[model samples]
Target: MKHRKLISLAIVPILVATFIATTATLSLAGSSINPRLYGSDRYETSTAIANQFSNQTVSNVVLASGNDFPDALSASVLAHELSAPILLVDRNTQTSKAALDYIQAHLRPQGTVYITGGTSVIGSNFESLLSNQGHQIKRLGGSDLYDTNELIVNELNSTSDTVYIASGQNFPDALAISSFASQTNSPILLTQTNGLPKGAQEYLTNNEPKNIYIAGGTAVVSGSVENEIKSISPNSKITRFAGQTRFDTASLAYSQLAANPKTIYIASGLNYPDALSGTILAALNGDPILLIDPSTPLVPDSIAMYLAQLYKNGATPNVTALGGSVVVPDEVINNVVNLLNGQSQSPLFNITTVDSRLNFGGLPVNLLPNKTIGSTLTLTNTTIPIAVFIRR
Candidate 1:
């Protein structure tokens, strides 16, 4: 009976499963894929993002003006809520064929394609173009950016005791924090550098949040602007995370908001599109993003210090580099990897030899059920004895 027990046993199944897994693990660190997302241009990059994050079937898609960034910055919340992807379209050019192709191929949208801006930015004929392709259109816009932002906030149908305020004049700071705000259900209201715009003020008056967060320095959004906000909501606790530069501001903002996330997305500081599309994915994954200088090939010293600190505090150094090598250079990638691997430990523990697997896979044959023969096995921090049943 003992010899007969060996006949039905086969370690080959276990060996084959482990071998395949070990091969795949060779290119990975820990369980995270550490994906580098990029494309030839912004339009394609947005599509690539959808491909990675959205399932093959989706009902809605958010379309924003590719000619500018303000509209898209406020659109992330809607996208996140609808489980949709945001695709940018050139204002005069209408919807880019790549975006339409992505929708046709991946999304299979039987519902609405929400447009962020009105006719002036995306053209009046745009809605018809999408309708021709069989998508119902819902337009969200107003006379200007602030009005549009207010409308977006109203669309959310939800608010928090906290609100994030950023300048509508520029895109960097707002783009940097959009993901965080969306994830937390905090609407990002835009204001001019000198004063709070009427629509934005109305938004504050309507919501009456308890905590107001300013996302940029005085230069981008002045003290006068901050005071205007405080006047509207005098009882609210106001906090500012500003810095000498946009990069520093982003770092400070991330430090304040992200409580030790598993992944960090690195996007270009100089441009907006990559970060714009990347934010939705970042929010979905519960990751925070840091902006980098696109012109330089080396990692900035401040960013390196920040990453090193995160590692020291037991945060996994899994990073996703957005944009192409032209935008995020190869040297920066090497520096990031080196910094994460600096603790004299490999990010991935690979089972390189059969001897290692034999020692680890020493389990009783009875534990593995029938037909699980070629299944992968994972043992973590456990002392249970695993046998390798070999049939000779």
Candidate 2:
């Protein structure tokens, strides 16, 4: 339940949406969806957030992006918004400049910068960026010097009093960490358990622990997990961060974080297709309840809320890109073809693709929408039209 007085929406998320299969002829050409034109009301940095939004306590903030770097401003703003420690996921030299730039822009000279991640892969100077930003930075383990497994184990082992959990995207490494934590018998516990699990679903009811851990705000702690929170942990703290990658990976991360009285789940991969959504991030109020970039906000609008509402209402978004292969599936192709099967000809269906992705430079096929075959028309050899990234 969010603020009903301030934010109003037909609020929905398209994560589990079942895209309708349409034939080219049946698609009903010229149909369009109402696109929302909105952005942030104000610009902000990562000053103090996540906490205000979380129903729990979180220790660190994790930055997970599939590409080069999360928008420096966005990450920096988020760190400031959460006011928790920060973790940069793209730990590599390729990311050095972006990381450094992030620090220079966000960190104050007196701040302490902590160097973590594979050292050899990401330069030692990475930590310096934070240190120079006025924050005190302490260098943690490095990947360049050791294996992430070893580093993760060593770090958790060294800090026996604290427990660390991995959340977000279904990364193999993140999943392994969850299994390892459950197997370990140390007092320093890294938690791993989903509220949505068949077993835990029953346990969480009135099982009333002081807190609950969420893997990522967007992934695991959603769907049935939402129901669990509604039934059990409504008052339970939601310690979530941006870290995990896929839906399952995030579930594991939230699993680990839930171990504590106050859990902190992290989102892993920010770049995965459909990994996020615009409508999902907008309801970005913290447990503390603050919306800095209310309009052009970063994270998807209340991913959890949207998921819950969409599921409840039986509505979803028009997202076809996440399943992979932007080439337009043969099913869709057939739909278009079949639609035109009965008719002699069908109007050309327009395709809008970004420029960089189109490779028409060396296309050998003809660049036409549908072809003319006898009395019936057909569409084939799309090497040209698929070259959306290429210019004519």
Top model number, lDDT:
1
What's the TM for model 1? 0.77
Q: Write the residue-wise lDDT of candidate 1 on 120-163 in tens digits.
A: 88876768777877778889998888888888888885656788
TM-score of 2: 0.33
Report the C-alpha lDDT of model 2 over 1-392, residue by residue, as the tens digit: 32111111112211111212222322322223221211121001111122122324343333323232212112222233334333333455354343344445554455545343434434555555454445664444423222322333333322122222232223322322332223221111122234333323333452444444443444433445445555755665544444444433333343343222111111213232111111012222110111111111122223333223333443322221111213222222322222222222222222222211322334332323332212232324432222111111
Candidate 2 residue runs with Cα over 4 Å from true position? 1-82, 85-95, 128-135, 142-350, 354-392
Task: Give per-model CA RMSD.
Answer: 15.3, 16.6
Runs in model 1 with CA error above 4 Å? 1-33, 92-95, 343-392
What TM-score, over all chains together, does every model reach? 0.77, 0.33
Worst 10 residues of 2 by lDDT: 286-295
- Candidate 1 clashing pairs? 362-386, 362-387, 363-386, 363-387, 364-387
